[model samples]
Target chain A: MTGWISEFMNHPATYLKIGWLQISVSNLLVILLMLATFALAVFLPFPKGHDDTQEPRT
Target chain B: MSEMWTAKLRTKWQKELPIEKLLPDDQPAYVASWIYVFGVLTLSALAMIIASGIVLAFEGPAWYHTSDAGKFTNSMHFWSVQLFFVFMVIHLWGKFWMAAWRGNRFRTWATGAVAFISSIATAFTGYLVQTNFDSQWISFEAKDGFNSMGVGAFFNVTNLGQMLLLHVAFLPLILGVLTVVHVLMVRKRGVVPPIDAEPALSNRGPQ
Candidate 1:
């Protein structure tokens, strides 16, 4: 279990070193992508006046 | 109390969601698309995850990993989370390709996206509390990212107690509230029509 798990964890880890910082490509990419997703979702301008659907009547 | 606030709240809700629209026995013809079902599937998975998680929380991790009943409940929780992510991802992609944000539905779209992010955060805390090598490694690795962002002091991923509290308490609460709001927004706004969808006969002229 230890051998295989360790090997798998070590195998795909593409590490980066910037000064004293150490990180993996996968981790960095995930963080960047999540931030971008949040930014786009929050900051994107709504395309107004395109709504033609009738409002739900009470 | 005069019940004024309660009466006003009920009136507002009724104004936004009348009986037929709130609990409709029917949907538009276009609702036949399979892609639309993913949202409900994700909701079902979330419900299962929450129920299973409650049981596991009562049992604690010791029983969860050791006892047969606990193992079964834990498996249910794990698989439900997997199903939740699977259904949610498909739902997200479907919305993207369909441009489900059209028709002044940006709030509905934004809520879903925010819910997705919240779910990921909850899942990360869930991983941190697993009490295994995987969890330890994950926490160690994630701590660096948090520290880099100056959030590690507040959000210590390596602390099992904190992670467990976050997983079973605060994070789940946030996720649950976000999910409820997301569903309510969807129901209130109604689904956006498909791109290039023709206007209804009522909107145009009698067919």
Candidate 2:
């Protein structure tokens, strides 16, 4: 049992647990993505008619 | 009771608002051109990507990379990601130039923009979960770049399990939800018109 733990730690793939669920560049990109998306959602207003209070001027 | 109040409020707004029920005569004769289709196409591609991704989830990584059915689906997912970005960028550019946000459509534009960014993240996470030699190599290389840039501390990129959760669980959900909301808002608001056009009914030119 002790040997297996050491062996896994030594392997490069151990960091990602790659054989099953692998992690790396793609995930980081996703993180960058989530941050960007979340930021945008918070800032941008919904389309005009979305606010019911506004009366059409024309 | 809240639903009733909400319905009553909506009915009040409908009666009071002087909103345009349909396109005015001043609006463009039609969507500007083929460029307009890029946004919809990108959306289609995103839908395919999610569908393919669900299958990959069911089959597991090894099955996806090794089995023929799995491999084809994986390739389709990969190609769809590339296609989505291509079309989405074009759509973004098209909207920017056309000034597609002139009228009530600002939220639609913003949502689409968010979806573009979110989809890219989803694609990035999917790439990380590929678990191949390329995936392995790219993770380490990408991390070094991030580390140098100061983003490495938050996300290691070298960890497969971490990447998988973010990719399959988090990124997709974010992108999918954002895209859906954007689409709904677009349907609700209708498209914005070309800049400088008069109302569609009164604004007449060459017919």
RMSD of 1: 9.2
**Steric clashes per prediction:** 0, 14
* Overall lDDT per candidate, in order of appearance: 0.79, 0.69
In angstroms, the error of model 2 at B186 is 1.4
- Kindly report which residue stretches of model 2 are placed more than 4 angstroms away from their true locations once superposed: A1-58, B1-28, B196-207
Please state the error at residue B127 of candidate 2 in Å.
Answer: 1.6
lDDT of 1 at B118: 88
lDDT by residue for model 1 over B128-171, one digit each (tens)?
A: 99888989999999999999999988999998999999889998
DockQ-derived CAPRI band for the predicted complex in model 1: incorrect
lDDT of 2 by residue, B1-207 (tens): 356988889786565332442223332343444554666888898888889988988988788878889989999889888778866776676678767665566777788878778776667766777889878878877888879989777787888888899998888888888887876665555555455555562233212
Query: What is the lDDT, from 0 to 100, of the residue B9 in candidate 2?
Result: 90
Residue B150 lDDT, candidate 2, scale 0-100: 92
Docking quality (DockQ) of candidate 2: 0.03
TM per candidate: 0.74, 0.65
Docking outcome class, model 2: incorrect
